[model samples]
Target: MPATGEKVAALGHRYAILLSTFIGLLLISNIVAVKLISAGPLIVDGGVFLFPLVYIVGDVLAEVYGWKASRRAIITGFLLSALASLTIWVVQLSPAAPGWENQDAFEAVLGFVPRIVLASLTAFFVGQLVNAWVLVRLRERTSGRFLRTRLIGSTLIGQLVDTVVFCTIAFYGEISGWDFIGYVALGYAIKCLAEVVLLPVTTRVIARVRAAEAAAIL
Candidate 1:
């Protein structure tokens, strides 16, 4: 059996993988968010598909690695996302080559409004932190039982914060009345529902990860 220290090192190695996936999904979600897609009667940003995965991964991190590790991952994702946005903003501002004809296209794809960027960053940071915090607290309260409850509860709260914050800041005046309410409601509902649908898969992944980490420790 490996020593406890060796096991911890192994677990940390696995964490690195989870952290990378989390950050990659986050950055990609921001980039794709430039486009809005219609799902039935609802309109939501393109990022909706991948964005919720971040929370699912976050739940795995918090449930297995604990809140501190999850917090570190969240902070890392935030800084890296901000960096990506800044880099894109700079690229968008730089003078285009005289013969270049795709500047509009480039901007259309990569350039995001400053307000939207601000809203995304702010919402992501707050929501991720809340997710980790809530999961950790619930773990403590429940003595680590009822993984489904922790996952679902934290995701519902976190996605709500993310949707409301992002929508209010990015589209408060632009979308009013029931439209605004529908937008927020749809986003939150979809995210929560996604979590519910993926619960079984998440349970399996968490179990495998925990078992692997335990074996490594032993």
Candidate 2:
């Protein structure tokens, strides 16, 4: 039989994979957020598709690994995002080769404004922490039953914070007041709908991860 320490180490290894996925989604979402996409009458930033996955992953972490682990992952993502933004800013400022003419394009894609970056990091930190914290509390209240309730409940609140904070900070002065309200309302609704739609998949992933962790101890 494996020692207690070994069992704990194995669990950490499994959690590390989830943590990596969470961070990858965050970094990619930030980069892609530069573009605004329209679907029918709804318009949203390009990150709309990818950013919600971070919260889904966070839900999994909280459900399977618990709040402490989720908190660590959230903080790590925050730091890494800051580092990524700083690195991109540095690269954007560096002089390009004499013949290189794509600097403008590159900046357009990756050159995040300082204000936007600040807004993203702040919103992400608050949103993810809220997700993890609320899920954990719900888990305790429900004694781990009704997975959908916790998932949807936490996501609703978390995404609301995320949408409001991010849009207000990033576009408050740039867009019209009505547009800002629309962005917040639309973004929150879309993100919550995504959680509801993906609930089955999220439940399966959580089950599989919990099973794997259980098997690791045996």
Candidate 3:
């Protein structure tokens, strides 16, 4: 009982909010990703567009806290994503009553594609961990110099891996070969650029959070 209590306390202190945010982001992104959309000439795929923010949040957690915290976030995100997919699949497969003509369409939209599911969850888990790890290491290596560089560079690296893995997994055969690669590359670039441009604001928010945490510690 004591050990269990201690473990719970530790988890609550170390990662309650980060885990919550990660799960929230992952679940919501999966739901939104069911429908693809467009902004201008860019074809913004569902879930992919909103999912970038998870990387940013992962960065914040890692930069201010540490890799372990970020890792916890990643794991939590992965598990929740899987759970969400399972829920969708279960709900989609269950029988629908008469007068429900849209049931088939609903299932069609929400049904899980095995390859895409594996690819998405795998890519995000691995990519987010890599992003957090790189950012933390770079910060230490540079002695905290070039904050923007670390933030942007880490995100770019992570997003590239994520895009390739997800696109290849989800759309490789369904899309024309050339279009598949092009869309993945374009999506990665756009997401990375957005993160880079948001660096200053991210830095400010991180600094504030760290200060608050430090004050509490002291």
Candidate 4:
């Protein structure tokens, strides 16, 4: 429970929440992405469900908090993701307690895959920063008009980069041919579609966050 006026580092209370939300979602997405699932005809990772929301919150951060703040959050997420992978790897190496039979299950679920981690970290860092930068630049150029254009456009470009980086590093050798291409194509399209579909909700969240930040400042 955050007490009234509680603050974390330089970010004020209200803004800190957004940063925390972004990092939390990023970490969870990576962990759950191991399972491949079928959503109608589209086959995707478990992360696909939660990961798009990562971008929605990211949009809020960029649109409401500005580039410097958004960049700080992005860097934080990247570093913490590496730390998580390291921690998981170390845990896997540690000798299990005698008679602990769940080690296999634990490893199966949470084992640290270096390639996947590298790909996720690289893609997230690049994708999110690109998302933030594009939004901020568009905001500046348009003087903040056309909110839908900014959100969806940035997501299109950012998701594209993210999908490419992640698929290449994580699955390039493991999955070849059209499977690789479809993996990238489907993930990218779904991510972009999520942004476009949720534009209204995203815009409202941004507005509300902006208002809250303004109120907190007073």
Candidate 5:
């Protein structure tokens, strides 16, 4: 329940950008995730490139803006992702024009988009909330000390939950037994490692955001 005039105002510019980027990453990841790419010996979805960053951004939001703001962004991304899927479904099902010979191609690429988006939204909503809650809870417990430990711990749990939920929903029956296990296992490992590796950058971004907000108050 948000007032139309003040909805965007509530987010402000800096936090608004973070929210928009979070949603953008979700939409783009879902769109490109249709393709399963070969990264060396590993078979992964195109989303592998962007999903970790999405989580990192989530961490930033939670770390800087706290739980309420983080939850709002997560919910917004979930709803927008659903909207994107619905939009694609409508376009894909519409009658094609005479020169439009790529209907099959369109359907081929965007046909199963709804399912993937469903899985993504579900996983994102659950995973991000858990991550944000854990982060905020830890901040409460530690008085904001141990930033690295909090982030790594939350990412470890959140990514595992997200990976399992997303992979099982998106690729369970689509891939074979061993492949499914590998996909889930590797994706989880990679997401955690990616966040861990980028922890310094993420922490810096969070710190800057907090500092800027504090300066704005003066």
Candidate 6:
């Protein structure tokens, strides 16, 4: 184990990167969430599809850095997202310009439902932590041989939890029950496929980062 100061310093470096990625993911996911499209039989929402990269980045952090580091990143993302939501709510309540006829439109776009925010925070927190834990444990178990299995498999399970919980809570009254299930399943599959397709790139980046870290240690 590293000495206390060394461990703190190491964590600071790790969190700097992790936190940056976390905030980026949170902001992008929420900003683009409104765009919904159809991809064959699937309904692809911008946030649902793109948000998996957050888990991918989390996986990379956990696999290389360890679970503790990953958890900090996950929690940091959650807190930041909450902060963003709160700020948006506050702004929406503030007075608009006298000539601003678009206040309603602005509220329609930016105002978040309480249920939706709660579901998002809860699901992301649980799913990401679960993903990181599963990835790290599987890596340890397999001696790091089945990289794809760990990455994709953990993502599959994690995204399922995220999709189901978030969709159920966010759209419970807005959508039919069947439609809710369909959206959740569609989102989960899209996210899993995305992570699988990005596996090669992820592997390469992880390797480079690990090498750099090792070199710095040396």
List the candidates' TM-scores in order.
0.95, 0.93, 0.87, 0.91, 0.90, 0.87
Tens digit per residue, CA lDDT, model 1, 1-218: 54777667887799999999999999888888889888787677888889888888988998999988988999999999999988988988999989999989998888758899999999999999998899999999999999998889998888889889999999999999998898789778888998899999888999999999888876
lDDT of 6 by residue, 1-218 (tens): 43466655664685587669866987789777867777786666678656877877887788878889888888888888889889988989999989888879978888867887898888898889888888888988999888877888888888888888888888888888787777677777778888888999888878876776665454
Candidate 3 lDDT by residue in tens digits, 58-163 = 8889988888878877887788789888988888888888878888688778877888789889888878888898999999999988888899889988888888
Taking the tens digit of each residue's C-alpha lDDT, what string does model 2 give over 1-218? Answer: 76498888989899989999999999999888889887888767888888888989999999998988999999999999999999999999999999999999999888859889999999999999998999999999999998998899999889888888888898888987787787688878888998889899999999999999998888
Lowest-lDDT window of 10 residues in candidate 6? 1-10
Ranked candidates, highest TM-score first = 1, 2, 4, 5, 6, 3
Better of 4 and 5 by lDDT: 4
TM-score, prediction 1: 0.95
Query: What TM value does model 5 have?
Result: 0.90
| RMSD to true structure for each model, in Å | 1.6, 1.7, 3.9, 3.8, 4.1, 2.9
Q: Which stretches of candidate 6 lie over 4 Å from their true place?
A: 1-15, 38-42, 173-177
> What Cα-based lDDT does every candidate model obtain?
0.89, 0.90, 0.80, 0.88, 0.85, 0.80
Instruction: Name the 10 consecutive residues with the lowest summed lDDT in model 2.
Output: 175-184
Error of 2 at 48 (Å): 1.9
Q: CA shift at 20, candidate 2, in angstroms?
A: 0.9
Q: Between prediction 3 and prediction 6, which has the larger lDDT?
A: 6
**Candidate 4 regions with alpha-carbon error over 4 angstroms:** 1-11
Best by lDDT: 2
Which 10 consecutive positions of candidate 1 have the poorest summed lDDT? 1-10
lDDT of 5 by residue, 113-204 (tens): 65677678788888988888999999999999999999999998888888888777877789878977877888888888888889999999
Please report the TM-score between candidate 6 and the true structure.
0.87
